[model samples]
Target: MTKDHVNYVYDPVVLKGRNTEHPVHPLILSRSSPREMSGEDIPDRELMALFDAARWAPSYRNAQPWRFLYAKRSTVHWQKFLDIVKPANQAWCHTASALVVVVAHKWTVDRETGKPKEIPTASFDTGAACMALALEGSGRDLVVHCMFGMDFEKAYKVFGIDRDRDGVQCMIAVGKRPALTVRDREPRVSQRNPIESFAFEGGFVKVYHK
Candidate 1:
């Protein structure tokens, strides 16, 4: 099929703002990690902006332990990035606009106490940064999909990563949202569990049932 015909198959969905006070909508709730992606290129500046948003995330002891190694979708470097993923993920991730290798350093010294500190909290800090990146991507009409299907040992060797001192947390596929058909993308709408099901009142004393 021609490019035009392919484009016709997936039309973009226009979303409008919803009332924020009416509990988080299902769209926010139903946001799932996208597996399949299209080969749409995202601007380098925009990617940088997303990382800037992640930079503002709070960290334990102010130790910002997250680091990202990224490559644009069509570059030669992208091939190296793709090689690290498992075969199953490689099939879909090959079409992503960008692949980001998320890493975290495992230790940091405490500035206040002037004592040696272990970076045991690096994973939490990295997770917070990933959330920031995702929210920023959502604001920019982009989707961020995080994945763990990678050979960390091989990746460390290939990327010259010190796995003992640093950790490979996850990989993120960032790109524009695609027009999905009912058969291709089921549930067309995102859904979420009720807040009462997960939320608790006053230190988990009782379930917060509505």
Candidate 2:
């Protein structure tokens, strides 16, 4: 593992400042996925800013195929969106300031062939865009949590998503994090697998071990 990331995953005290030994930005290390959302609505401009950040993520063939469906906490659509989430997820997520559904175009017409072809990187690129949105929200001190704990069939029906062309990629809950209540579970940061476990040098010829 890179020393900085190792410190980040194992030693909180070593990650005290932006200029800590970590090689990346402090925002990355500090961001957390918290379930205790404050239920306050985000300002419209602030919310759009997150989307604006997502707009810049790179994609294959320059096909930025991601689409976002968003609903603020108090809107009629918000309840409808919340109802699609599993009750376990909704128990914590209903307090989020906004619910964002990430979708991707599964197929795009080939410009040259004039025929539809699967965009192999559509889901991959959408995930990168989601990270961009997450980083932007974290920079603004907002907590963002992405999930798979929703009813995809219900989501497709409610959002009018044509599954043949579009994929319901994932869901995100965004809000200013709230203080944990006694009844609420304790908030804790999770660890990551060491970089050594995943990163390879020349090729996938060999894997690193601690």
Candidate 3:
């Protein structure tokens, strides 16, 4: 574990200018997506631990539809994965230790009917799994950033995905963050909107927007 992971709770870099309306876990508050990485390859053991955490995410009828396809830096598959990313993203993603494509099984086979059945909750369940993966990486002081700037169609072709049953959700860049000084940390920590702005008491309510 890095120094940030060990002292996450007390790290001035994480706690600086951040506060929640209600009390929450320190780990939740410490999580942030950093673009700058060390380009150092993560050990398979540590990397798989993130996916293991993702396995426990809740899903509709326990479908567990999420799947992660990844390529580590300096590997044969690295160029292929990188090619799928957009130029703007590639600028920063080149330093990522690993690139992962999170896919969801949009259909599941029904035992009773012995036929493919649509899974409406596939995307929602997969998102939860992605959150678990990101949180786990954050807990380990790793940069785990998700992006939508990849060619989904190209990914399907490159990965040989079944378009009829599977859908690409998003891409994830995982890596070790470069050591940071306090002066350059603020931009890395994003602020959240207050609960009242997003969470309504009972149902949806009209809210003003900029």
Candidate 4:
């Protein structure tokens, strides 16, 4: 167990964005994903608060089809959750206070037809829930990091789900931010592309221009 990591309390990296860029909340600007973490254990009440935020996210047809499986660092299931992480991620994930598996139900039975049909936005809806959960974690002064570097097949078996009915989306690790050394030694902030590059206006394939 990497419980001793709490002693390496490195200063947090501050991410600041100019207000002139956009009228965004400070929380949105300060949010960041850093690899190093202090291995302090989060209480159950605080953990539940994060999930509560996820539960309130909007979903199509009110399905809200997201499910989560989580384990605290001190629990028996902790190692099981860690096993699915990619090698590169484990370098920091091992010290997280809690690990989570985010799953999306791929299909649902229609009330009228009584036959199962694929939920077109299942994954997207789940992503929205995950984001809500992350932001909530941030509000509580906790650092949240989502990682796709997990073995989906292994997770499917570990979580005991049928591939046809459910999709193993990703994992979320939560804890206090770690020292810069826990991540790439040379810690430099990453930049998102300017709005015009990805956001489009009038038509598909057309980017928004200032």
Candidate 5:
């Protein structure tokens, strides 16, 4: 584990009622995506700290090829961010505190070898960064909802991102949710699928069943 992972702490509330048979980090097992977010703005330093965690995510050969561009809610860039989202997403995401564009490059030079390394799986590396960011946001009592229902091509054009060279993975909405109302109470808590459903023991031939 990286130093950041080792130092990460989570709220006790997140651990409540989680299965003891197969222990997993509460942050990973309990994190949820809020459909509605608070309009309140997040401090710039806090946002930067989350990005810092993403920056340190492990990558193939340390290619470190993820880039993020964000627009703070209530700013001039907010409309640009909103315009890219699908109408369905706009209904909920407009209330997000911030919107970010995630980009990934397909290749990078190996620092030690001074040769270009083909990153056929750049999206996987970028996903790792997104996971780190999500965990960091959760640690701060914030929610991060990733959305792919957006005009990614248009966004790439607007942002001057070369789609041929860089891939626009998805947009992330980061914020705290508004206080839960009576109707919203039930959906506030979420659960994840059992690990046995996805995890294998030694190989694909050996399926672990709970």
Candidate 6:
């Protein structure tokens, strides 16, 4: 990680625009992905700690299927990993300390039939794992940005992941942020919709609720 990264204080501007209807953990409000990074290497132990958090994410049938493939900066695998990202994302990702490819197994043994069955919640469970990793990174005050603008198919080939058996979830960029100045105008934390818009009492709510 960058020098003083652990000691650096975040600018209040990052927290200015967010508000919530119901109270949540302060960390939830503070976590926002920004593209700016310090281009410094993260310690191996710190990175592993974040993955440890992901390992605990809940999965259906206890079928913990999430797999993370990563390459750290200055490593032989770094260029190969960076090359798979689309040109647009590569612009900012060049400064990232680590790049992670999230993958999940597509099948699990059916308990009843003892046969191969598609894991219905593979994507959902994998996403939960990613969120846990992201939250852990956030709590550590690290920049952990997830991106979908990469070549998903190429990831399977580059990382030797079986496309038929495993699904590529997304790519994540992890690094330390450069010092923020008063002039730095990074985007503020995003606002989320009210719960009533997505949550319902009994049945699905078809219309958009303000």
By lDDT, the best candidate is 3
lDDT of 3 by residue, 133-204 (tens): 988888887888999999999999999999888999999999987876332645456688888888998899
TM-score for all predictions? Answer: 0.75, 0.82, 0.89, 0.83, 0.83, 0.87
Residue 64 error for model 6, in Å?
0.8
In candidate 4, the residue pairs with backbone N, CA or C atoms under 3 Å apart (3 or more residues apart, or in different chains) clash, namely 36-178, 37-178
lDDT (tens digit, per residue) of candidate 2 on 1-210: 122211112123223422333376565776657677888888987788889889999987878889999999888788888888899999999889999999998888899999988999999999999999988887776778999999999999998999988999889999875665212453354566666667678877566456
**Best model per TM-score:** 3
Tell me how far candidate 6 lies from the true structure as C-alpha RMSD in angstroms: 4.1
Q: Per-residue lDDT for 92-187 in model 6, tens only? A: 999999999889988999899999988889999999999899888877878899999899888887778888899998999999878872226655
Q: What local lDDT does model 5 show for residue 68?
A: 93
Off by over 4 Å in 5: 1-20, 181-184, 206-210
Location of the lowest summed lDDT over 10 successive residues in candidate 1: 2-11
| Total colliding residue pairs, candidate 2 | 0
Model 1, span 1-210: residue lDDT tens: 222211111122322222233655444433445555557898887788779879899998788999999999778898899889999988878888999999998888778888767787899999999988876676665767898899888879988998777899999988866676222543344444655666777766455446
Residue-level lDDT of model 5, residues 1-210, one tens digit each, is 333332544545445635556767787865656666777898887788889989989888888889999999978999998899999999989888899999998888877799877787799999999999998887777878999989987998899988777999999999875786212444345566666766778877555446
Give the clashing pairs for model 6: 1-41
lDDT of each: 0.74, 0.79, 0.86, 0.80, 0.80, 0.84
Please identify model 3 stretches exceeding 4 Å from their true place: 1-11, 111-114, 181-188
lDDT of candidate 6 vs native?
A: 0.84
* Model 1 bad stretches (over 4 Å): 1-22, 25-30, 113-116, 179-210
